[model samples]
Target: MGQYPDAYVQYLVHFHGDRDYFECHEVMEEFWKAHPEDPRSATYVGLIQIAVGLYHSRRGNRAGAVKMLVSALAKLQPMDVRTLGLDAEELERRIRNRLADVQAENDGYTDINLPIMDPGLLHRCQTICRDKGLVWEAPSSLENDALIHKHTLRDRADVIEERARQSRLRKEQGEAR
Candidate 1:
């Protein structure tokens, strides 16, 4: 969490661009694994929980949303959200608001605009969102039959290849030991 990892920026890309909340979890989890000993690992995990919670909320999974959001808040309690380049107070407020709705099973999933505190980072995220034809902070189409829910319908050859490569590296390193 000291020098923000490249994965965090990539997480923002998927978050704003594709609205692929699952990928947000993957990228951040990978980074968190690399720094398990970091004192702030809980903050990283909390962010992943936020992503998954939002994903569940969008899919109308009220129960799942509440569980993840509650766990995330607990993990986030001891840390300052600004330490991760986010507007800490606003994020907590948004999470709490979302949680209330989730618990009630009434309000729909709201677009959580993670207020990035750093001007430069916000500019970069905005530019990328523009390039991708996505509007930052816009609520995604969540109609029951919408295509976003079927994201796995798209090909993921690149991801599979990367997983295979990483598996080989780990197997080889173990043999060397």
Candidate 2:
């Protein structure tokens, strides 16, 4: 197994395979929130921005794409991509190129194919993708027409119930104190 967390691996797989930007954000965000003290929080957010930015681009939201990509580039500029087991120079070059493409706003969306330097990590990601019956390195798409916008069809009951449960717990604890 690689030194990275399962969440990071999941993020990579969803990124390279399913191209589910929203899912990428969820996995990475959960990891970052769980380990807030880690220096990788910014890194995770940058990765999230890449996914969301691509999603926006694919959906033809030029303005949102530009904003997210710009923010991602700025966050990643100061960090060494190798810390996340990637080729530092190549990753930066790709991001720079992507930023330019996004700024031009001609194409709908560009795939963010980051270079992975770690063989083990790459292998693990590919394996996960295969296990999940997805194609690696394939550009993601909202092919499920009805599922294009997740919130429009997803069930939010569990999330709402969990939030209410947490709220009740907090209130009970406050009263006890």
Compared with the true structure, what per-residue lDDT tens digits does model 1 show for residues 1-177? Answer: 345667887788777766778888989999999989877788889989999998888888888889999999888843457776787778888899889988888765566867788877777777887988887766667763433465556578998999999999999999999
Q: After the best TM-score superposition of candidate 2, give how far the Cα of residue 55 lies from its true spot, in angstroms.
A: 1.4
Q: Each model's C-alpha lDDT?
A: 0.80, 0.79
Q: Relative to the unseen true structure, what is the C-alpha lDDT of residue 57 in candidate 2, on a scale of 0 to 100?
A: 74
Instruction: Tell me the spans in candidate 1 whose CA falls farther than 4 Å from its real position.
Output: 1-3, 77-80, 143-177
In model 2, what lDDT does residue 62 have? 75
Question: In terms of TM-score, which candidate is strongest?
Answer: 2
For residue 52, give model 1's deviation from the true position in Å: 0.3
TM-score of 1: 0.77
Q: Which ten residues in a row have the lowest lDDT in candidate 2?
A: 144-153
